[model samples]
Target: MYRIGELAQRHGVNNDTLRFYEKHGLLQPSARQENGYRAYSDADDRRLAFILRAKSVGFSLSEIAELLSIEVDKANRVCSDVKELVDDKLVKVSQKIIELERFRQSLQILSDGCCGGPHSAEHCTILQALESFEENDPR
Candidate 1:
């Protein structure tokens, strides 16, 4: 068994992270000492490692919770259970990349339109383009 600080140190995470994990049901201490300190077992270490791994792969807390739920089910295989979630996340990430690239193109257009120096605000092409887009955007 290990104290909360010890466990956090061993895992290279903050004490608050351990507490937050406990509060959010991502992790649980195995027991409490007489002095009211939390004591963690090796199982807690493994769980924390799993949480970290999931986080590194871009899983949100809610998604991690779902994954943990799947992990506890004896009949569910990990690969099949996790594949759909990962696929969905990948789609979302791809969409974000496309949106970001579009945004970059728009910014480039604005940058190319603007010839910066001694220009009045009313004569700024960038400002004019922004106002035009704002008024014309249906979405």
Candidate 2:
């Protein structure tokens, strides 16, 4: 038997994370020691490691719970569902990457326009460009 702190350290997780996992039903119910402290077995450590690894790969708590539920059964439906979720996440990640690239390009344009020479804020080229946009806005 291991104490809660020991188990958490061994699994590279915090005590609050363990408590949260238990509350979310991702972890099996913990056993209590005679003094009312939580005790864990080696199996619990393994389970927590699985949860942490899944989370590191972008699985949400709810998704991890579902995965755990079907882990023992090896259900085809569950496998397909997880695949779909991963596909959707991939799409969102791709879109975010594109958006970031666009933002970087825009920032580079602004940086190139700005003069590094000492100048008042009112005369700054970057500020001038922003003022030009404000003037052209219909709103």
Candidate 3:
């Protein structure tokens, strides 16, 4: 049996991380020692590894909980169930990438409009653009 610290150290996570996982029902100790320390079995170690791996791939705690539930009852789950979750995440990620691209384009426009001159800002294109408002701006 491994102590909590040992397990956390092996996993490169803080002690509180382990406790948080336990509290969130994502993981648990196999037993508690006589001295009141948590003892983790190999199965617990494997479970922790799974949790970390899921997190590395952008799964939120709640999503990871869903995955863990499915994992615990794999016999009743089809592969499409897991694929659908990934597909949803992919859509969200793709939307974020598009938003970021638009932001980059806007910044580029503002940057290209400016000469970056050392002169005063009285006639700076960037500043003027910032202060100018167009119709139908909605605010």
All candidates' TM-scores? 0.82, 0.72, 0.81
Q: Candidate 1, which ten residues in sequence have the lowest lDDT sum?
A: 72-81
Error of 3 at 27 (Å): 1.5
2 or 3, greater by lDDT:
3
Tens-digit per-residue lDDT, 70-92, candidate 2: 77567546567667777877788
The C-alpha stretches of model 2 lying farther than 4 A from their native spots are 75-78, 125-139
- TM-score for model 3? 0.81
What digit string (tens of lDDT, one per residue) describes model 1 on residues 35-55? 999999998888889899999
Residue 120's C-alpha lDDT in candidate 2? 73
All candidates' lDDT scores? 0.90, 0.82, 0.93
Q: What lDDT would candidate 1 get against the real structure?
A: 0.90
Using lDDT as the measure, the top candidate is: 3
TM-score of 1: 0.82
